[model samples]
Target chain A: MKIPSNLAKSSLLATGIFWVIGMTDGFHINMMAFMFISYIPVFVCCTGTILLTICPFYFFGETKHFSKRQVFQRFYPYYSIVCFALCAYGIYENTNETFLIGFFVAAFFTTMQSWIWFAKESADETV
Target chain B: MKIIITIIASMLFSTLFYDQHIGLNLTVFSLVTLVALGISNPSKLRMKETLIVMGLYLLTAILVFFNHSLLSIIANCAVFFTLVGSFSEATSSVYVKWLNGIYSSIAGTFHRNFEDKSENKKPWNEDVDVLHLIKIIVIPLVVVILFVLLYKDGNPFFEEKVAAINFDFINFQWILFCLLGYYLFSNIIVPVKVQPATDSDLATENQLKPLEPLNEDNLKKEKQLGTVVLALLNTLIVLYIISDIAFLLSNTNFAASVLSNQVHNGINALIASIIFAIIIILYFFRGNLNFFDENKTLKNLSYLWIFLNAFLVLLIIVKNAQYIDAFGLTYKRIGVYVYLFMTFIGLTTTFLKVYQIKNLWFLFRKNVSVAFMLLVLCSVVDWDAFITNYNIKNADSLDVNYLIELSNNNAFILHQKKDRMVLKSNQGARIDLKYSNYVSVLEQSNWQELSYDNFKLKTDIKSYEDTK
Candidate 1:
């Protein structure tokens, strides 16, 4: 029961969407700094969000079998590049918080691009 | 068994929603959806789907309870339809879901139980289908009721002979309403996905490479046709834009009606031409023609065409701004801006589709997703207040009548602006009307129906009372 790669990729992209949009909303940058100090609740939030995303893929994905590595394949390369670029930009501009968001979205699309490649390759199986 | 469930659901819908405000009744209605789904299609009743449907219901309920404006009502209907569609297909486009939703509603209300021709159908005696029940009971009851009415008009003493079905909840009209509700709930409880529409949305493939051979003669012909059409279109659009800019530069002053006609008609024509542009692009790029080795010229021309259309949209926006500057902001004018912005999004997506050799469904999915997000965002804004306040401050010739026609969302603003406007008496009367409408809007409300906006309005009224 091998799962089509697109569903796993879509779920990853969905999680990135949640992080980029949800983290940036309502809670300001200053509040986000506090989230770092009160780290337990933040950890809980991350776990809940991941589970919320993963549950859907587990249900609607092509197979019952779940592999975390398959979804994360080729993700590190793009994430690393995006992370470095955002870090460099943050240092240059003397802006830390906004570039934190810059990192979220950068990782979002980097993860998105990685998944999109998988999605494209696995299009026939899903469609 | 499902028929019995449908009847129960119908009874619940008719009883709860008959004379109630959209409050907890919406939550109740959502529960009915859950119960119906649980009974008929228990396996599909997952937590994700139930929670999402419940969320949609809660959102619709909250929006209407707060404002109950036309936009809120429209959003409510949209959410309801999306929920109905969600029961059947989880991955279809919102538009297709809406189509499926509306189809289910119509089919149910009309007792057109369009089930699968092979296995889903049951004999009338075997199971009481909606149409069979309609034939056995509703037709006779309706004819008898019609004749009773006619006979009551003909002979004064014949009213009692009609058997006196005049109970408050058991009357003929109420029964018919329940019957219709039963049919509707029946269809909704067991959702139907229009296969072709759902199939199209399920098609995630964006590329056109597999439709035909890249070296096909038709691909070359399509490329040639597309190139010629786009080139000619580009020339014409450039000329049109130049003349438009020339006119805007020269015409410093003009009649209001002239500007109004120009702006409105320009937008109308722009909508048509943009749609035409998209259609042509979709047609030319529909297939393996995109994979043609020499399709670069056609693709470049299409991109230029899209960019020029985007420019045209901007030019119209400028014209609309000029019109607004001269006159005032109204709903129609504001609507033009929203429409233009969405049109720009459409063009951008079209450009992406052609550039990436994506299929038309890709364009649809992107634009529709954006449009839905925009709609959800719009549901949060009180546009009545925005339009009224902006017009009150900036309109050269304020139409107090038009301002008065708006909902109570702008009531507080109008009340504040009464002293500042030249038309004090008219403004005062409009404010009074708003107060009366606000009262009526909340006449049947419990705490569940009171929105934060309503509380704010009440507070505003109280503050005004204290000052007075």
Candidate 2:
């Protein structure tokens, strides 16, 4: 991804990657995504997307540019800002606390991703 | 060739899914994705890959054909990751490959697209290249479309003119769906790997290496320390088990709440302790202790501890059985049984890891594959119907409300048993409401969306009505 437009695509790619990973493994995160996507619990319907859309790719998949690290770095700022805004919006509106949960989700996933990326690097050095 | 397959797959996606619910179409689409993956990576194709692919396909096919549940969908997706990981890298453990599959799917899409885009940038007229054609057509069309839509929103004349422009043939939403499908298909057909993580999984051995202590005598002292700790822990567990068995033998009739506490809170507590027991054992055996010349005493203690944990799982199972016998089964109780079974497997695998000198990865590999297979095995059963029938036959008294809360799989069965059941308060009314809804949905559903259970329930209801 050499161009500015590609940078935007990579950022969107990061969000898509994060969202799908949440779907495959993160049940609670999947719940949150559902809250955002729902009109009277599209959760069950959201589930079939796993089989029809992503599962085949998982069993058999591909992608890269600007290094994964750079792509994530570009994405991290925008992602965190959006999550923080949502978190604040919930408090301001005095709405459901699940809105506040976005910040924690952002933090928790950041730590996990960092560990996945860097901890193995440290571990391989030891090996 | 890749582009053409992608286009076909995308259009197929939109056609199958755009206006319909997930049913037979999903199963068909899943199969198509599998075929596409095989074609794209024919070199990776092997006997084992074929078996895994077919097994997963069978699970998807059978589940959808029978009683497609959320669990089946989940099982299918999870196994998909395991399938991708193992197919691409044969050496890594199942758990590692499972995670790698996700990483590969997401990262691989971007990486492969960028890599392939540089190669496929030729003029669109030469071939029906999606990316090139999309680039040439989509950018300008989208820009103009967006501006026109905005102006139409603001101006009545522009709106009327726009409406008259005969853009009815240009279904932007369908195009977008096709594009979305293309992006997704691109990922599966050209998957990638996270090399470092896979390497780590590959390198981690099951056998414990001998720790060369800075002082040779330290290994002996460490062994002594581990032995004392294990011995003390074993004594405590033995006492706990003896008392637990004695209480079981007392034959005190437990109140529903008391029994619930024993199974839920008490057993869950034991499970937590067992987790700690394994963690402590792993910590001791983490290194040189496995290779110690005089480590037999410590190893024996560890084995005993593991045995005791397995015994605890058995005790919990017995308590759960008693609860089920008294109050009957709920999905919560079934969850407890599954959790305990998993704990038992964990203990068994920990035993193998220690006794056989296997690595953590070996434990992970064995357990993950077992879990995956178990889930796939479970996908064939209609759990709602199973629970309903078991409760109706075996339960002392029914929680009619709870029974009614289950999926329509049990609606026909429960309706049939209404005369025999003694409902408390408005329970009969509740079942009536549920039955009416179930029948209505069954009658109204498209044939493609209805599973065998749904059809069977509808048939059973109709036949019963006819007899009446």
Candidate 3:
């Protein structure tokens, strides 16, 4: 599957981050840490991964053009973002101030990213 | 959107707090989602959706079986309920669409072409009030009434019980062996019966006459064969009724024993039905039968009859399996429903190979033949004598050790069913059984001195008074 070069690169970077996070602190992350880490880096990784998976099929024609590296780059961003947020929530769960702000941010960004991804894919497919 | 948000919130809350009720929560959420989906896009679904949903549910079940996680299991259940709701919504939508399409087509045709028709020149296709009434109200009322009746009759209030003694391990094995024997006999022992080739050359050489209708005499003879079939059927029905009444009338102990036998009989009858189906298939090709005709009404009637009869037979087989268990037979988790479906499908396939008959008649003959054979076998067996002579009853119920010793000295003793309670050892010998106020103490003593004497088993009735 030939994805756009940027999307492919994003997928690869996100894949590496997920592999690391899932095997380590990212895997152990709980609900509270998500509020802080979720919006910034984790959100970026998740959105990136989502874009990488869908972009090639949605934008490119029958010809295969995207490289493995590009494909990986496309997915890595979204994956790293979600994983980091999840890990952050796990680390800072019980603190009252941390949980309230962190949880709100995580919820807002994750849901927004999902909505934006859904709309973009739906619109791209229409063409 | 609001409902969706609420549902999601509830799911998360339930997952965190009341995990045990996850299935219930999922069911409710799936139902609401399904309703929302239908309201948003009902036009996309059709009749085939039910098949898809059933397939998906089965797939999810297989996945959950292998995964063995609570979350996975609950997710599978959620999918299952969602599929159920989606299929139901699709069915209702299809029904409404068909109804509206028919109504509008009729109304439009009438209003357009007959706008100028006078009273004397009334259109031939004018709708009647009663027909509309039937469609709008009466038919639905009838359906509701039938559903209510079915719900009452089909509801299972009592659980089936298994008997404590006399599990038939030997007979079951022998039955399987017999089936294997039949399979071998068909392939190895019996030569295939081949028919003469119906080629033109062979027909000319034999100077075969052109096809003709049967003569009057032959027609009369064939009619006699039909009458014979009818007479035999009537006799079988009578015997079945008698056997059923006798079964109901028998004592509790006898009922338990007999009913256990009856359940085995039902299973055997299912096997026999399969054999009968094979016979029907072989006969169909061999007889050169033609069941179909160009008559549409006849074809529809035949199909309708077959469906209704099949449904009824299925109901009976399931009922009998449950009833047999209740009548003191063991509940083999694998039961007659499985066999019934297998045989029904086999028979239907074979029947389709031959002539299509009225559905009710087809099922009646097949199921009746099975029920009849078992009933006849049960009636001919001298159950009491078998219990006495063959030592079929529990060993403790008979004096086995005493009988063994006495028979060695040229005297054999047989014990039959008795109202009194009894205990005997192996070899048909009666051990000393003494009843007293302190029977437990007596039982604890050495019965070696008392072993030689035959003792009748008895029950001592007592009321415990003021022990408290």
Candidate 4:
């Protein structure tokens, strides 16, 4: 509540900007204003995609027993690293356009994993 | 904040150089991320764990440099994950912690965002703030746009470059690269936090309890039952051992078929029986055999039974080696060897548990640690290369098709030895087809596939082709 934290707000805004920039094929004057206004849709889509992929783990009450710290610290990094490597290899092989798209999605998830966990760790420690 | 900024800058720099060469790009990426992580979380690793992690990392790096095959990639991922998980504060299983982190990063972020929006219910003020932010960006953005347009119109060179920027064809590849860069930066700056398992958590989870106390009469009955069971098992095992010596060790010319049968069929049942025997002994002697004055004979018989199981494991290993020598190596054979070794260790540890009168947890912990160390040790060896080389040297029994599909690490050797190999008709055709496929893959590979092994293989193949 009350904007959660600066980090969360900034991350959402950053993701929105990335989506717009990525989808628009770089900046052009005619659509620049429109794209800027299109941040709302971009934000909604990105948020929905992320939440859709991740919310089932929570809704099923998987995290009930283990706290976030316990869950993230043990195995998330390994999963992220493995995903990152596979995506990277796909990119390296120049496989297909889908792999190209997949790399970004994998990278984003990997980065967000560390960001959220680390931010929470620092926050808890500071508090 | 500065650390985060520096990490982001490094990420951008790495992305720019991503296509330079595979090895160089990966090295830069890994080093920068490590640096950022070190700066953000300056916790010192324990000497032993640090050494283990370093060794694993070094091995993984070498594997990658050789070739970024799926094995190397997975191994490298394992190294980093294990390093981070071991150092983290989490006492839970590493996998559970990782999932929690992923879930929090995505679902938690969205939940927080919604909650924040709801709490900020003063829509007018929020809209004003948004408008103010937009206004701040709009003025500079509009000015930059006008200046860029004017400059493009005035200068032909600038105009040419501006026109070259095509908005119609979006390169998702570059976008993916940038995303990877940013993600690496973020990961380094913010280390995941893990919580140690608490006492309450352990209590809530059901734990194995040692056998409860027995009354005097029940204890007497257990002692009698243990003695009969131990005596009968020991006699049967000793007879089996004697027969093994007569049938296996005494035979000078061991047939491959017999050895294979012994290993495949006999060893499995033997191991299972040994496990059953140990469980039965534990059941009977759990609370009754600890007293030395009353159940000495039963205790000694149990010890002898364990020793006999160890002997059987040794015999199984010998048979397995013979089978391997006769038929060449396969993953299953290698796995069997590892399994036998673990079985040996398990038996030895169980014996120690009984003799030392230790608790079950002690045995569990020690065996688990031993298994983990064994895995780490195995990870150090390049099993693909080892298998390929062994099979090649024993080419009479080599499965060429299997060798060809092993890993890119084996490709160089296969290519080099292709001329000398006298393949059967079907095998020969398959090998040729496989070799051609490898050549095509090499040709299609871009700068991203640059590695010491790939480079060497390419050059070797080129020379071979030129000679042909």
Which candidate ranks first by DockQ, i.e. highest?
4
Worst 10 residues of 2 chain A by lDDT: A54-63
Give the number of colliding residue pairs in candidate 4: 8
RMSD values for the candidates in order, in angstroms, are: 23.5, 10.7, 28.4, 8.4
- Please report, as a residue range, the 10-residue window in candidate 1 chain B with the lowest summed lDDT: B109-118
Model 4 lDDT per residue over B379-430, tens place: 5666777887787787346677777767656666776676676666676666
| lDDT assessment of candidate 3 | 0.36
Looking at candidate 1, what is the lDDT of residue A26? 36
Per-residue lDDT of B433 in model 3? 26
TM-score of predicted structure 3: 0.27
Alpha-carbon lDDT, every model: 0.65, 0.65, 0.36, 0.59
* Per-prediction TM-score to the true structure, in the order listed: 0.62, 0.74, 0.27, 0.64
Instruction: Give the winner by TM-score: 1 or 2.
Output: 2
In the range A13-110, model 2's lDDT, one tens digit per residue, is 33433344333322331154343443223223223332343223223321233433333333432333343355346545643343233323333333
Question: Cα deviation in Å at residue A85, candidate 2?
Answer: 18
True A-B contacts kept by model 4: 0.11
lDDT of 2 by residue, B74-148 (tens): 777776666666555756677766655665544445444333333354433446666787698858865776677
Candidate 1: segments with Cα more than 4 A from true spot: A1-127, B1-12, B20-57, B108-180, B196-205, B210-222, B250-255, B424-427, B437-457
TM-score of chain B of 4: 0.70
RMSD of 3: 28.4
